[model samples]
Target: MNQHFIRNIEVKKVRHHKNFSIHIDDTYPKHVIFTGKNGSGKTSLLEGVKSFLELFDQYSIPALSEWRDMVRYNEKSLNEADPSNVYLTDQFRNQITFFSDQIDQFCKKVELDIKNAHEIHHLLEEGKFLIAYFNATRTSSMLTPNGVEKVSLTKKYPIQRGAGDVFIKYLVDLKTQAMFARQEGDLDTANRLDEWFSYIEYNLKYIFENDDLTLHFDYKNYNFLILEPNKEPYDLTRLSSGFSSIFSILAELIMRMESSRTNLYDVEGIVIIDEIEAHLHVSLQKKIFKFLTDFFPKVQFIISTHSPFVLSSVNDAIIYDLYEKESYEDFSNYSYEAIVEDFLGVDQYSSIVKDNLTEYENLINKSSSLTQEEEEKVQKISTYLDNAPDAHSNELKLKKSYIDLKRILREDTI
Candidate 1:
């Protein structure tokens, strides 16, 4: 089923800096949602869809030049401050070098649009589609050039030459003695590297079978808890920075959906989730948008959110509202009704559902028991935020300020 479609996207001077453009309506409810705030430019519009998913290798080329140095930043004074100012352009300029020195040693010249830079780099190099930048390197850490501080991914493919570095060195030596018995801490080599990373995440992608594959992870106590009977390892910094940001966004969307499967929708990819309701838990941000609407329904998700439960159970998602445009070095001539009234006139979706329903009713009254259907769904969201009123309208004032932020998380658990 090898599919892909991203219709439109544009960003410039990158991070928080705008010369923005966004258009997507590739028909049907393919489901996509993105609201904004924390450094708007929502992950620099997911680094222009991971630089259009590294022009289709779907990830390779040092994982798209280490995700274009994570939403590009490096303008050694815009090439020594405007060295004849050509900057960077590709929309099919051909000599295709969209700027680098590993993104100029960390995010610099991220502004684009030179009169539609040769027709948006020839429609993102003819939409082989690729773009997925997320959580802007949350707490920035990545090391492994043998310095090994944390950036882990080298069973081999960081480069050893071809066949995807010989199948990542034969799957790290067929799971290198269970990935060094769980990185040498051992508990039966970390339960055989957590059951061979859950059998390469349930036998790598759909050769067919369907039940939409299932497994978003929370394996009740992890280090990779392969059926945690009592092994207790999950200390990726004591899980819960919203479960280590949903295990670093489900390990970068299951290794970019199991390295471009080569066919079934042959890696056309597009994922732009920024602040996708960060540090989630409005039921794991509604199970991360119902696991990206039924696990990558032919991938093409654009997200930037301030959350109205990630924009009311998104359908064919599209809503923009970025402001500021004094005199175009950029916020790209702002207009779309001043970007949806600068995010619904700073109501910002009722303060992102009153700060995620006060952290989802304080993680369900500090979870010890709940089952009677999460106590009648926290008593019908505490009787509709104690009988709504305060001039409610911005979607019922974000559903009664997320039901009085889940009744101040059940009054701080009484």
Candidate 2:
């Protein structure tokens, strides 16, 4: 039998702090969700997982070159003939090359005796062992042996042969603009690009109208089209942000699922999604959360979100608290997914929180009669909203929803 586990995550010499760790027990669910305030190291923690995997695949060396003192350059103290003096840049470059060679030598000595059969399995458990990262920073071009070149969609490119990515460039294009154009010495490829553009222009009308999604691709090169798959193109501005965000997420999840299935029982696989609820509608948020339960049922999913709508759909999760104290002290808090599971189970509670947030939005927009006690509580929640950050609007919305639910529950007792 094959088994997979994350084991643990540890960080060092990173942006946030000197050190931090997250330990997961076997009690973790196959589908996991993580909720925390912004800047709570959620993305950083997820990056740890990706970084570790990249190390195993030898793709992370460039990013981590500084850590190993691999950068070598000239030293002014010694002459050029002797090992005395060298130019700073040359010394830095030479040291990096030496370190890389040393590390490769070390790996050869150590890797042979160990087994890594579970590496692939663990990663695929979360969908597609080949990590497909989607964030705002991804660019339109990636360096290749030939030089920087335009990326293609609809067909695979030679430069992307070793990289196991399918469709990330399309997601990036969702927020940007993409059009087919001819490149030097490649009219056929340009024509192919034109065909893809024509197809996208004709078939993706609905997505364009919604203006909520961005598409990306990882083919001959990386490209973002700022479009989604649709039957017809609509005015990009009219589409709902929530809908488009969910569309981007769902598309990626589905693609990953299909890819993961090709290899079953592999270890060292995981899917890390940052801000899983970005720019999505409330209803779509809830639906997407629920839908994810079905999409990658066996894969381990680690998603970060500030949206309560995203929280309500999770059956099990690890909640990390990033609150701080005034005396320059740092501490963190955690809650099991079970607490969230039970909290969202009440009928009034679930109904108000689970559905696409339109219902709650309508309720908030309408007036409601309240008793003295009920009125006082709603007032308190509203007041709390005054001090909350703008990024926490969803948290406030959830707070208000609970207040309304409490009011209804209290009236039932009377």
Candidate 3:
């Protein structure tokens, strides 16, 4: 297994960040999660890392330079007083040297002029590296029936619409090729397709926990189908948003690992996910970290999230809480409420309720007889607590005490 790690990252005058540095390696957790308020440069940092990785390849250096120029210019003042600066340190740059040999070897392969030849070669080329970036907005459409047949015959890979949709299109294309092979008595090619499909199915079932749901390649319509245990088959397009998000990411990862011929245990690469908790329910968010860690133990996952539930999901993860400066806080043992209050800057209890409780306490502790205004204030506080949203058990018990105090005050006044 080829291990790749960014020992440290330094960025200056990029996006909303001025100067920032992050350290990541074996000494730290393999999985790192970034949490911050919106516009705190979380996505910017991810993009910076992506660009840095691209620089490792000779073929991609020019593109990275061009991108830097564009970002620098756009971020500069009208007079161009400040320039955009972004680059990896020599230490981190040296780490990516290990992948260069594999990348060069893959790019040197002889070109094959066959149907879908470009797509196959492209997939193979990408397989040389394990690095992938998953965009938050993913598409779910598959190629139309006529379009699939045309591409299958022409052997041309279609332009990708989105990561998820493109992956499904690849599966459909492979299935079509298998059909063609079967008609021509090419059983070997057909058998290879079957094996790939079975691998995908097994992984999906194992990771997704949908034992009754089976994946099917709809060659006739050129769509992906999911057959439920006791329900009718449905198009992959109709899957729930949360399921679609997770499935698309998993499918892409599995496909990349398979294409690169990387073993499950030896797969080492960086995966950047923006808004990792988007569209996921609380239950799924809590379980997602464990699943990903167990599934890809060697892969380094960098994720940005806003969910407290997601924050509390992992104990060993390196957490970067971005504010004015990056703070590495230990939240491993913090409760959900503590995480929300301290890290997220949100109080577990409502301020209105707290204020009312305070007023009720002060009134009860009075040494002199209650005035008309104080009596009226207590009545309003009681009314407010009665209508307020459900609170903690301790708070509820306190409310009961306030009610008893109100009864005593009324009887004393009478």
Candidate 4:
């Protein structure tokens, strides 16, 4: 199937990223996983990507033509934004041309002559292209517009579209209708509604690891239930935080796909999973990459994660480290711990322990005998470890090192 994915992306001067780029090719899998520290621009990259796509999808042709001149940067805002390495208002316009060219190429690749804003809008209205962006903020409340919410095709989704609630509401409505039809002895109408929803039920069930698990919506309680073959049913929250997270994510993805007149196997577009491991267990973190890929075979997945456990399934996947500005196509020989400590340059020890160990080791390597100042510092460390009611393991070890270091200053190991 003809499709589209980000072959390369460059965020020259976007939020918190002065210059960040990732080049993808057909050599690796279409799914890309980005990993970084907390303040290391992982979320910022996702924000930038979403911003660009929103621009491409929404901007008119005249707007694109005049985007560069559409903004005036105030001095105060620019100065404030400079500290965060981002823009005041001009950043979005500056990248309009780049995203325009990308969209042009993407259209050509998909065999669509969507050269201008109207053409893109028309194609999107027909559901020829779609985006399934599951933003990190998943706890957003339901939006029941105009006192009614219905399951229908939509070209775009706001960052906070909680399809999980709407999806349940749709099912509850359908079940209610089916119940009324059955009470009226209209078995055909009731059976037809079940047939219409069979595929979705199968999809929801198959995504779970346990095939015996069955999902049911409790219209009275307004919650979902998970029942197994022999065990008693329970609320989905009892499983794991990650389970409900992915369940909601998949719920939205599938709903969007079906509403677009597409399916998981053939929908062609981009998917953004911001902070993929935010609410996931370590085990679930290890499975999400493959699960997403297998579930949506034709879509390009760009997800961000902060967990090292994600390395468990980086198979044929491009791994980008935004903090280090490094990209790896393969780390098959490295353990997840090694990736965290050595490859990613994260020290396992705390700052105090590492610094004290460094000071002690420096004294050991430099001096054959202890100086007065060195002896005083060692005595201090010993006191800190002794009088402390509860001390860290490394601190206790440092206390022992102080004893031996006082005996001989020529020690270089911690």
Candidate 5:
């Protein structure tokens, strides 16, 4: 079995990040999450990893000049706004030359830290171990590329950014080729193609909790059809944006891995997804990480999301809260409200509820000097708030406020 995952990474001024580093130890879960607000280096971290690994190719470059797009907007002003090649300063030189020296330095460090550079690059090219980053370009449609018939063993290693709709294209090309093989009376070849695609199709059905769902290529209409157990079949285009977002990611990822590795079970490597909860429902957000980790058990998933529901899904997953600069390995016991409050700095309570809670807290502060009737009233309010039905799931946060007042009366402090 071929396996690879990042052990450590360090970078400076790679993108919007001035200094960034991460280390993955053996104790880390197969699934990891990086989460923060917009413009908080989540995307930059993924970009840095992609840049670092792609540089090891030594022969073919990885469109490194795109690093300019990954920088601080004002940093562009640091470059000569010169349209025609005349520029001064290290910043402008870095931009013009695609950060050549920094990339060279980073690649040298990678080669030193993770030796066997030749073997690593070769395995990556063969897709023995995959490393890919996915951003928000998934909703776009895919068109089959010319000359693409069936999966080719020596297919040129693809960089995903060049084609946003790789998954759909993979499906169209493979299924279309299978249909042609069947028409040509090549039963064995057709069956082989179907067999290759069915693994991912079956897993997709499972991930979606749609056991009776079926996928078909509509050659007549040139559409991919989704057939539920009882309903009439519909085009993939009819699916919701949330479905499109997640389905495209899963399809592209597995398809790319399969192009080199025929078995889904043996595929292993890193997959970084930005804004993992993009169009997902709250329930789907909670299940997405667990679903991916469970289905693709060997692959290391490093995902970013703004959803606290995602943060609370898996107990063993590593969550790097970039905004807080904190890492947590166990969070399943945390309440959704507490996760939101502590991780996102979001106040999950309504204004009226917040106002009332604050008032009760202030009243509790007077525990050192409370009249008998006033103390009784404060206790009643606190109890009511504590026992509120909606407060059940929020026991973690509720313990600090209204419930703690009960402790304050006995201990003379809140």
Candidate 6:
């Protein structure tokens, strides 16, 4: 496959911006991560890219009518006769031109043109160059049986409404495909399906370290079951939120990769995941990127995350911290603390704990002797630190800080 990357993208009057430009290809990382506070236009930027890709696939340009309706409100230019006219002369117009030229260049580079539209369509149908988008507002409610009903491959899959529905359907489809393959004496295809299932099981076990729990598919009922080491198997509905979330994401990704005739380790395509850290623990967030990179080495993952753990885990990814605008910042070498404070705009430790520590320090500085109130506050902080969960490495540093503060208090008393 020809190497294709979005060289640059510029937008104006899109949402909250007069002009915004991002040059991705110039500092091309293996993957890209979007991080920002809420209402920071991260999702808008992702949607813009998605729109461009879809329009390019259809050989269509951004229509002026669509822009007029979609463009950001011109609050400053209310006096203008037509606010939409401003878009035609500003960065929005330039962005349209840029997208058009880039799409043409990319098509030529990939040997896709008007004459090869049929070929492009075939490739897209086969899931080649797939652009998978996972919306943030996914629900983890029970996967209804109707959601897993056999879908015709001849038709496009329905847009997933529930969080786990798409994954459940994919799992059911795989089982169906495997059974059909076996009946047709296609052992290789059946075996591949089995292999994929085993891969999922292996990774789940590795991550969870629950040797007793194993993933099982019930061919009889077309349902997924979780089998304990010695206990009776349970339905997927009984699984924990974390397990369900992880399994759903991994299953969907594996299915997409397989559709393109790519193995777990060799899948190549673009995957856009909004709120990638949703429902994931810090430990899982740290491992998720590593696992994804190992599983889908060639895949271009564009993710929007709010977790410092996720940002810190990835070293070779381009991190775009979108606040007022989007800009590529190399966060591969940044420490977790730096990532939290600088990119995430927050302290590494809890604000409550930091405040207590600051107050304790202030009291200690004001007088050489420790008062009853100051001593009680220090003791309270020390107790809090002692009781705090050490799920993260930063917690250890916090614990040390508490110890040092106690030691200083002791010295002051002496």
Cα lDDT tens digits, model 5, 374-402, are 78877777766666555565552555455
Q: Predicted candidate 6: what Cα RMSD to the true structure?
A: 8.5
Error of 6 at 177 (Å): 6.5
| Candidate 4 lDDT tens digits, 1-414 | 433456677666545566445776633335677776667777767766665566445654445445333333333344455555545436644555455564443221122112233444445456555565676765323332232234554655543343454655566567677778989999999998776566556665655556666667676665557777877787644545566678667666655566554324456556788877768877777777777777777667888876677765767677888777788876666666566675555755567755665565565455356689987986776565445433544445665567565545334432
Best by TM-score: 5
Predicted structure 3, TM vs. truth: 0.63
Shift in Å, residue 229, candidate 5? 6.0
> What's every prediction's RMSD, in angstroms?
19.8, 14.2, 11.4, 11.0, 8.4, 8.5
Top candidate when judged by lDDT against the true structure: 5
Q: How much is 285 displaced in model 3, in angstroms?
A: 1.2
How much is 4 displaced in model 3, in angstroms? 1.0
- lDDT of predicted model 1: 0.44
Query: Which 10 successive residues of model 2 have the least lDDT summed?
Result: 325-334
- The lDDT values for all models are 0.44, 0.43, 0.60, 0.60, 0.64, 0.61
Model 6 alpha-carbon miss at residue 43, Å? 2.4
Worst 10 residues of 1 by lDDT: 156-165
Pitting candidate 3 against candidate 6, the one with the higher TM-score is 6
What would the TM-scores of all predictions be? 0.26, 0.42, 0.63, 0.61, 0.69, 0.67
How many clashing residue pairs, candidate 1? 34
* lDDT of candidate model 2 versus the reference: 0.43
- lDDT of each residue in 1-414, candidate 6, tens digit only: 324444455554446744556555543435778897777777876665555455434433334224334333322233343646765456555555554565444332122112222343345555554456666754344453553476433211212322334556667778778888999999999999888888777777766667666877777676788777766778766656665665555655555555445454464456677777778777888888778777776667778888878887866777788873546555656677767777777666667766665665565556466778878987776666556553245655664576577667778677
Can you give the lDDT of residue 339 in candidate 5? 75
- Where is the poorest 10-residue window by lDDT in model 3? 152-161
Off by over 4 Å in 1: 1-49, 52-248, 253-281, 286-303, 308-321, 324-386, 389-414
